[model samples]
Target: MRFLLLILLFCFQSIQLSAQTNNYSISFDNAVHHEAVISATFKDISTDTLTLRMSRTSPGRYALHEFAKNVYNFTAFDSKGNSLKITRENPYEWKVSGHDGQVNIKYTLFANRGDGTYSQIDETHAHLNIPATFMYAPTLNERPIDVNFSIREDLGWKVATQLPHVKGNTYSAPNLYYFMDSPTELSNHKVREINIDGQTVKFALHDPGTEDEADTYFEKVKKVVIAEKEVFGALPKFDYGLYTFLACYIPNASGDGMEHRNSTILTSTRTLANGGMEGNIGTVSHEFFHSWNVERIRPKTLEPFNFEEANMSGELWFAEGFTSYYTNLILCRVGLISPEKYVEGLTGTFNYVWNSPARQFFNPIEMSYQAPFVDAATSVDPVNRENTFISYYSYGSVLGLALDLSLREKGLNLDDYMKHVWKTYGKTEKPYTIENLNQSLNQYAGEEFGHNFFNNYIHKSDMPKYNELFSSVGIVLSQDDNAAYFGAAVSITDDLNGKIQSNTKIGSPAYKAGLDKDDVITSINGKPFPNGIQFEAFVKKFKPNDMLSVTYLSDGQEKNTEVILESDPSYAISLQEKNGDKLSKKVLKERKDWLKIE
Candidate 1:
């Protein structure tokens, strides 16, 4: 009987070894006028159906994207050179059947101007954002997998991946587990490499212009990275990389970021020459912290990714919000930003959440599960779209700050909770739940911090005591009044003549003015307002309760109304350093140190 048991154990080990030996080699070589050919070969697979997926969801966006919709010219073949039948099972997944044994799949992926997929124009440049094109099987959830890629040598293209490079033009990864664990961004983006704390970190992006400007911007990023690592103990992997692709010019823009194992892809407006460093640093810090929080210690639903549909989890707040909270905190700790700057960041989040009308409609958890559908349905209407949706990023960050302070008030801090989380969920390789988080916090705070605080404040609509929390840390949250006030959040369409030809409803006083969806605001208060600046200035001149006459063109017809001016409910938060006795010097000192070198 003992001998039989030994044989079973040996068989299990052999199966594990065989699974580990499976590998994938991908080559992106055929670059025609506008399209690129991607070929992938998989070894030692016995499944009758091989499923390839174009991920609809990415790390940063917290939304579903139909990535396979972007792919074209897909085909699959068996090892014997016989054609395999391929069928589209869903928008994001494809199934290839009749695989005699091993198989090779090749497809031509279209590169569009959108941020997620493979994008290219001329030989001068190309961008390969992996989630948009790369497809994998559902069976290999946490299985070990490897990927190798060969690219055009003369294109002057440098590939950046979180996957470790085994040799020249050959990259080796631990498994399909780690492959999806990290997303790769291959582009002609600019590259910078720095060594800190015995780890080499690489930053790659398209060089927009001016060496001095680039250096100044990246130097601040370097400092933030160093500081974040110091706080987190050490980066989880031996080597790390950051890839930023400037797909287009970004001027005061907003976008999403996708986190991979060792790398992340950020889509944002082009960093301006002035203060670009600060902006880039903030972005880098947010994405980098995901290395610990979400990528490793993920919600159970996120594990064994369900590419066909949404993997819903109410804990997205912890995944994204905690990362957002730490990003600014790390910046403050590293001295890249002052304590005032850190507070200002938190205040921005606070005001954003407070001003959002959706907070009244949906709790943070409900919004987490429903955001994908809501965002997709309302993609066209900017105000109605996101205003109705809650961001774990915004609210979660605030909650993180509050939770940190609450723990501190009890003679503990986020560090203890984080350690508890890492041990209870991250170390055990388990999923996150409210119960688990509460239990962990109970252990750390020596009381039921999770149930007592999270249920009352986070899971419910109860407004958090931001003033009290910030006061505990020697920061005061202030409301800004002098900022421009538009009674309604409006989206304007410019005519060929560059005139504001149309204004769309974005849930404001304008929406309540019996204004139809596409009303062309010809004039406000008897003044011709043809542009945003004019509209903003016109709105600011009137105080709340003032009577104003308005004229608009609807469906090519003239319209008029007598409307009452009202205050814009949109709130913005500012931070001030407090030197009062509300917080003890010892508490302030501890909080400051806690943020720094965490």
Candidate 2:
């Protein structure tokens, strides 16, 4: 009787402890009207210093933005309203000292930039983009978060957020923790709801058009979501929301969509012309798929995100690149995109990957780790550019395709890989390591596939066997004939007067002419080539092995040499094509069967 009583007491204590450890609440007030106010309440159960943080950077963007600078009128108080001193530790972090078990921090955030935390002041309506304005305790990863928002907009203007509304225009959620830390796009956005697989999905557009267009776009998007869910076996969550904001006259604005637990904010060009729907659909698919990869199954480095500094990871390729790879596949599988279009996209990516000089220098995995710094730098020193760079997107997509093919070749398939990854990593509460990735792949392959594959391709500078992979899939990867190229690859810089200021890469012809880096090419073959276009035009007329009298200013001395133009193998991918024989009849039949098209 004594032992049973002791057991009951211990079980009751454990339940109470669990409840105490997970307590947290957030309340948002728009009573102030000018700025969005957020109040977070939590119990401090640890000895470590309590810190509040706003993300320095989002997944889609490679640049770091100090979001905490936007915060204003920050004040922390004890349960009895006594002011507690809060210190600004960094641009994106704040530290509170002398805080015991329970505390509440209140702050007013100015949302004015349409890009991040933004608000409109005109008479029409008021808008707020949430992620930029709301601040949270960075260390409370596993705790439940509740938000109460009071929004102010035009009398008739409706507000939309991924959070379930407890009252009119006011939203609340049991937990804002985990990847659910999504920004709210609160505006007079046009709302359209559709049901797919018995789940309701909402689409909110900044400048939505006619009812017919909305219906058409929503139907297509619904099909896409269904296709992805079918492949993954189930949707990540029951409710999902998409918020799209369109911008006019910006050069593919540097921003893209960001994934949250139940919502995504997609920044895109306003013009819906020239197949804009296709681009929008593709973006939607990519961001939506993140609900599976980065949101649930995350890298160890990403779990306790360093909002003040760069969180480096070697697996962003898998997080982002694999997402890129699967987007097209899902689109094709759903009949949203034709096989020819898919092949064309893959061909373009291949050409881009093969032509870049960075491929000769850095492997994909290395590029993944150094992305935060290298990706942010605008000016690339010519010498370093040759050795330490590659596009993370391109490298990742290529590997994604290669891995998919390898899986299919082994009869395991991408579907199997996705399930294995989800079961081992996605379902876990903790982020995964490189060892976890290797173990998952090895389990599916029943061999040391990860070791052999990464050692040769990922960790090394070895390129993928594109020819073999594409052929196996019945897709002919072909190069276009009219692609432009210089007989020798040359990186050029021009002066203010449009004259050749420097030749960063001295091709065989330029090298033979005694031209070096920083050499000023005054003229090509006697005629003055004043600019890049003119220089390129002059080079185009010359055939391989053709000799020309080249004149340039080298070290303030006029030099001339008989230079022979050599063919550039760097342009090989442009010249290469998947021959008709490469796409065997068997593979073509499989493509027909999979696509349900001839």
lDDT per residue for candidate 2 within 1-598, as digits (tens), equals: 9999999999998776545443323222442344556677767547435777776665444456566766787887766778777787567777876666566787766554443223322222334444455666656665654455444443344555666655654455554343335455544556677665556667776543555665677777778777777657876644433322222112232345666656666655542443456667877788788778777778786766554566678777777778888888888878888776776667667656665556666677667776677654344555445334666777788788888777766665766687788877776645887667777777888657878777777777577777776666675554434433343333344442222333434233554456565555565568764454555665666666777766766667877766666664332221112442445577766555444465
**Reference-based TM-score, model 2:** 0.75
On lDDT, the leading prediction is: 1
- Predicted structure 2: clash tally: 1
**Cand. 1 TM to true fold:** 0.78
Write down the lDDT of every candidate, Cα atoms only. 0.63, 0.60
Q: What local lDDT does model 2 show for residue 304?
A: 61
